[model samples]
Target: MPETVFEVDVDEDPEDQPDPIVNRWHPDTPPAATIKPGEKVRIECLDWTGGQVNNDDSANDIRDMELSPNHHLSGPFEVKGAEPGDMLVVDILDLGPFPDHEWGFTGIFDLENGGGFLTDHFPEARKTIWELDGVMTHSRHIDDVRFPGCAHPGIIGTAPSHELLEAWNEREQALIDRGPDAQTGVNHETGDDEPPLALPPEPENVLLGDMDDDKLEDAAKEAARTIPPRENAGNCDIKNLGRGSRVYLPVFVEGANFITGDLHFSQGDGEITFCGAIEMAGYIDLKVDIIKNGVEKMGTDHAMFKPGYQDPDFSDYLVFEGYSVDEDGTQHYKNGNVGMRRACLDAIDYLTNFGYTREQGYFLLSTVPIESRLAGVVDLPNTCVTVSVPNEAFDINIDPDTLADDSVVTDRSDVAKPS
Candidate 1:
C-alpha cells in the first residue's frame, strides 16, 4: 500500500475532520499535506454532500439540501516545487468504496435547490440507492438493472491565482446579475424562474481547511463555489477519469494547492441530474509529478487528461436520437444543450416502455454507464445528439430487434420521493 498521507474518518463530519475538508475554491485554503514530486499517496474523501443525504427511502433530504457545503473536497495537498505556469500531473492509480460501505446514491435535486437537466418535466426530488457487488452496481429502487462500475473522482484541480479567482468572481456574478429574464442565448434547463445563472461566493457554511479564524471571514467572502468547472478543472464531472488516468492541470499558485473529492462509484455521460452519479465516500491512490513549465509547452491554459483504458466494453446499444427542438415544439438553431436534453428525454421514454416510472427511468439514466454524444453540430439549424444505453445493463432483453413484450418488466418500483 502507498503511504496514506491524508485519512478521513467516514463517520466524522467532513467539515470537522482531523485534517479538515473544504467546499469553496480559494488559493489560500491551507494544504493538509505536502508531497514530493515522485511520491504516491492515498487520500480519503467524503461524498459530495458530506452525509446530508441518507440510505433510507426519502427524498426530503435532497429537496431541502443546503447548497453551500457541497462537493466536500478532500485535499489541497501542496506539491513541493510546483510553481505557476507549470503543469501538475496527477496519476489516479486506483479508487473504490471504503469497506463495509459498498452502497452509493444518485439524486435529482428539487427545482428550488438546483434543478437538473430535465427539471421542467420532472420538478421533484428523487433518490436511488445502488448496491455495489465487486465492480457491478444494482439499484434496489429500480428493476432489471445491473452494470459494471466506472468509479472515478468527480472533481480535481490546482489552486487559482488571485487574478484568475477575481476573474471567476466577476464573470459569474455578472451572470447572476443578469437575472432570469435574460436567456443568455442557450436554452438551458432553468425551468420557470430557477436557480441563479451562476452561484456566487457565499460566506455561510464555508469551510477552508486549517485556515485561521481571523482570516476565515475575509477569505470565505471571496472563495468560489464548487458548482461549475472553472479554468482550474474544478468539478468537471468527467466519467472516464478513472484508475490509471493522467491529468495535466495548469498551476497558478506556488506549491500547486491541489484539491480533489466528489468520488462517483459510476456515472453516465452527462451526469444530467445536478446531484447525479452513484456518489460515495471513498479513497483514491494517486502519484503526482510536476511538469515544469509544461503549460507553455503544450500551448494550452486549461487542464488536459488522458482517460483510463479500463472502461467496460459493451457490444450492443439501444440508441435514441433528438434534434434541437423543445418538447413544446419550439425550434432553436444549433442548440446542443437542448439537443442533448431531448436525447436524454427520448431515452427515458424508451425506458418507461419497460414498466419503469418516468422518475425511476430518469434516476437510472443518470447513474448508468450510457453514452451521450453530440452527433451533429455543423449540419444545420437543428443540431442532432444521441443517448445510447448498453443493452447488457438490463436482465431482460431490451434490444429492439428481439425485445420482449411491454409486460416484460411487470413488477416495477418507483424511486424514493418525498411524501
Candidate 2:
C-alpha cells in the first residue's frame, strides 16, 4: 500500500520562525519529509498566491491583493547521497483527493498600470477563474457537457538560477524605470505592432489592494524594496508538482539551488485562465539529490514529466514554447529546433525507450496523450521550454513537483537524431 506520510493538518502558528516570509502559511509541520522508495505520501499546502484569492473569493478580491514571495517548496532536504548529474528518481506513490473548497488557485499578470501582458486587452492586473473538480467537456462545444476539474499548477520546476537576481540587475532597473510594460504593441525594432513583450523580471512588489491609503503607502516602499526572484524562478504554482513528480534542474549555484512553493490540488492541461484546482495548505516532503554539470530533460518515459494532481485517465502531455526578440528585432528559439516533427520525434524516441511496444505506444499516445508545457520568452539567445508527458506512457515515477531536481536524464548532445 502507498504511504501517506506528508500530510499536515495541525496548522502551525504563523509566527513560529524568523523571516516570517517562510512561515507565511505553514512549514513542513508534518514530521517525516522523506518517503521510502515504495511509500505513498500526502502534503499540505496553502494557495499558490498566498491568500490573495480563493474559491469563495472574487476576481475583484484577487485584483486588490498583496502577496509575498513565499514559494511553497517544502525543503532543501538533502537526499541521502545524491550528487551532481545523478538523477533523483521520484515515484508518484499515491495522489490524495481533497474537496474543492479546500484548494484555491489563480494566474498572475501585470496591467498597463503596472506592466502586464497584452496591455491592450487588459489595462490592469487580472486573474481568470478556472475549475479543478476533475471533470470533462465536449469536443466542439457541440454538447453542453463540462470537463472535469483536474486542478493542478502550471509552473513547477527546479531552482537553477537562484543567484541570477544577484548577477542580473544591470537591466532590472531599466524595466522598473520604464514603468508598466505593454501587453501587446509595436516593438519599434521589429516594426511589428502585434509582438508580445519578452519575459518580465521576477522582482517582487506589493499590489495596492484594498488596504487604506496609509497602509498602502507604508507597505509600498518595503514591498518595492523587495527584489523579485532574480533566478526568475518565482510565481510557478503548478498543481502537478504537489504529491509526486521529480523535476530535473540545472545546478547554477551551490546547494543545487532548489526552490518550489506554489501548490495546487488538481489542475487542467492548459490552465488557460489563472489559478484554481486544489490550491490549499498541505504538507510537502522534499528530497534533494545532485546531478553533475548541466541539467537536461527528465525521465525516459512521458514528456519528461507529469502534473502532480491529475487523473490517470487524462490523456495528453503539456509542453511550452517561449518567444522573444532583441533591440535589433532578432528572434531566438527555446532550443535551436523550430520543427514540430523534430520536437515530436524528440518526445517519441524518449517514450519508446520507456518500454512501449512500438505499435501500442503510437496508438496509446495518439489516443488520449499530449504534452504539458511551461511558457517563457525574454532572456538572451535562449528562452524556456517545459514539456510534460502523462504518467500512463512512462515507466518511471517520481516527484518533480516538491523534491529537488539535480539530475540530467539524457545528454543534450545526443537528444533527437540517433547516433
Candidate 3:
C-alpha cells in the first residue's frame, strides 16, 4: 500500500475533519500535504457532497441539497519542484470505495435545484443505490440490470492563478447577469425560462484548508466554485480516466497545488443527471512527475489526459440515434445539445417496452457503462448524436433482432422519490 499523505473520516462532516477540506478554488489556500515528484502516494477523498446524501429510500436529499458547499477536495498537495508554466503529470494508479462504504448512489436533482440534462422531461427528484461487489454493481431501486463499474476519480485539477481565476469569475458572472438562457429550459426557483447559466462565488460554507483567519474572509468572497471545468480541468467528469491514465495539468501557481474529489463507481457518458454517476467516498493511488516547462512543449493551455487502458469491453450494443431536432419538433441548426437529449430520451422510451418506468430507465442509464457518441457534427443542417447501451447489461435479450418485450422484467419496481 502506498503511504496515505491525507486521510478523512467518512462518518464525520467534512468541515469538522482534522485536515481542512476546501470547497472553493483559490491559489492562496495553503497546501495540506506535499509529495516529491516520481514518488507514489495515496489520498482519500469525500464524495462531492461530503456524504450529505445517505443510503436511504427517499430522494429529499437530492431535492434540497445545499449546492454552495460542494466537491470537497482532499488536497492542494504541493509537488516538490513544481512551478508555474510547468505541466504536473498525474498518473492514476488504482482507486476504490472504502471497505466499510462499498455502496454508492446516483440521483436526479429537482428543477428548482441544479436539475439535469433531461430535467424538463423528468422534473422530479429520484435516487438509486448500488451495492458494489468487487467490480460489478447492481441496484435495488432499478431492476433487471447489472454491469461492471469503471471506477475512477470524477474531479481533479491544479489550482488556478489569480489572473485566470478572475477571468473565470468575470465571464461567468456576465452570463449570469444576462439571466438564464432561453434554450436551456426553466429555473423553477426563480421562475425564469432557463436553468442557471453559471454558478458564481459564494462566501457561505467556504472551506479553505489550513489558511490564516484574516485571509479567509477575503479569499472566500473571490474563490471560484468547483462546478464547471475550466482551463485547469476542475470537474471534467470523464469516465474513461481510470487506472493507468496520465493527466497533464498546467501549473498556474507555484508547487502545482493539485486538489481532487468527487469519485464515481461508474457513470455513463454525459452523466445526464446533474447528480449522476454512482457517487462514493473513496481513495485514489497516484504517482506524480513534473515535466519542467511541459506546458510550452505541448502548446496546449488546458489540461490533457490519456484514457485509461483497462475499460470494460462490450461488443454488442443497441444504439439509438437523434438529429438536431427538439422534442417538440422545432428545427434547430447544428445544436448538438438538443440532439443528445433526444437520443437519451429515445433510449428511455425503448426501456419502457421492457416494463421499466421512464424514471427507472433514466436512473439506470446514468449508472451504467453506456457509450454516447457524437456521430456527426460537420454537416450543415443537422448534427447527429447516439446513445448506445450494452446488450449484455441486462439478463434477457434486448438486441434489436430479438424484439424485446415486457416479459423480461415482470416484477417492476420504481426508484425512491421525495415524500
Candidate 4:
C-alpha cells in the first residue's frame, strides 16, 4: 500500500463493482480491477517459445523442437491479498539480451521462415541475415540501411480458455512444421522432414492450385501492399532500445498470458522483414500485478510505451494487441495508425535532442507519409501493431553515453557504428 510491489493478473468485474475498464477480450464487458496510481509491477516476460530454444537454435533443432504448444508467458498471475476494482500496473524496467548470436539471425517473412510480404509466395525461398549489435547491419539488393531492434511482447494478454489454448497450440506447431519451415538448410528437401499441417505434399505455395504462379505473384505483391516489409520493402529497423524504456499492458483474462518471443537483431519501424534480428530465444524480466477498480482510478487501461518516442520525420512505430486477425486484421492496421500519432508525440520529444521544437517536429510528422506494418500474430492469443518512420528524415543529435534515466527518448548523435 505504501511502497512498490509485484503481483499477478487477478479476476474481478467492473460493472458489478465501482469503476470499470472495458475488457480487451470481452469488449462489452467490464474489467476486474480498478487499479490505483503509483502502483507498479515488474514483468519477466519469457521469450516466445517459453525458452523452447535459444541462441544455440538451429533449423534441425527447430524441426525437432518440442514445446507442448506453450505460449510461454511468465504468468497470468493472480494478485492475491487484494480486492477487485483496481488498476494493474506494469513497468518495462529491463530486458534480457541474447548472449549468443549464431542463431540470432534476422527473420524474414517467406514461407521458408514464415515471414516476408511475398513470404507465402517464396515461403520456401526467403531468408536474410542480421547483425545483433548497435549498428544493425542488413542488406537489400545492393543498398543497406541500419536500425535498432526495440523489442516487446508480440503476444501479451490474459489466459485463454482450455479450448482456445489447445487450438492455438496446434496452430503454432503447425506453422513451425508446416512444410520445410524450421529446417536448417535454405530450401532443402521437400516436406520429407517437415510435413504440412493437413494437406498432402503439394508444390510450394500451390495450395489447392487456386492461385497459379502468376496469380500468386500478383497476390504476393498485393499482399505486400500490407505485408510487413522485407525484400518487397526491406526491414524497417528502428533504434529506440539502447536503454531506459517502459512498456505497460492491460490484463484481460486471468494470469495475463504473456508470450514474448520472435527476437530480432534489429528491426525498423514497419518490421518489413516480418521479423526481428536474432530470431533466437531470450529472456525478459517483467512483473505483473492487479490493481482493484472501486478502490482506484485510471485514465485508461492501455499501455504507456517507453523510449517514449522517436524522430518526427521518421515513420511512427505503433504497438497494438487484440482479437483474431481474420475478422479485422486490416482494421488492426487502423489501430496501428493511432499508435503512430502517439509516436509522433514521442518523436517530437525525441527531436528536441536534435534541436527541433515540439512545433517543428509536429509540422514534419504532419507532412510525412508514415508507412504501416503488421508486426506479428501469435496463435489466437495475442497480436501486434507496427509503425515505422524513415531514419533518413531526421538527425539523431544526442550522445547515447550520457542518456539519463527519467526519459525514454534518446539523442542519436552518439550512435557510432558499433566497434
Q: Give lDDT tens digits, candidate 3, residues 1-419.
A: 99998899889998788678988899999999999999999999888998888898999998899888898989989999999999999999999999999999999998888789898888889988889988899888877788899888888999999999999999998988677653465564576677658888999999989999899999999999998998999899899999999999999999999998899999998888878899999899999999999999999889999988878898888999988999889989998898898999999998887778898889777878889988999998789999999988887677755553435554687898998
| Per-residue lDDT of 297 in model 4 | 62
Query: Per-residue lDDT tens digits of candidate 4, residues 1-419?
Result: 12222122212211121222111111112123322334444433233333333332233333333322222223223444333233344444444344453234333232433433323222432223334453233332112234444444343333333343345445545754644545443334542443333221212221111224454443322121111111111112333432244444444344343222233333344443333333434444444455555122655544344553322234333222223233223334334433443444455466555544343333333222234444555433434444344554333323334345446343322111111
Each candidate's number of clashing pairs is 0, 90, 0, 64
Total backbone collisions, model 4: 64
Candidate 2 structure quality by residue, lDDT tens digits, 158-200: 3333234333433555653444336545554565544232223
In lDDT terms, which candidate is top?
A: 3
Q: Comparing 2 and 4 by lDDT, which wins?
A: 2
Give a tens-digit lDDT track for model 1, residues 270-295: 99887889999989999999999989
- Root-mean-square deviation (CA) per prediction: 2.7, 15.2, 2.5, 17.7
Whole-model lDDT, model 3: 0.89
Q: Deviation in angstroms for 323 in model 2?
A: 13
Instruction: Give stretches of model 1 more than 4 Å off.
Output: 181-192, 402-407
Per-residue lDDT of 178 in model 4: 46
- In candidate 3, the residue pairs with backbone N, CA or C atoms under 3 Å apart (3 or more residues apart, or in different chains) clash, namely none
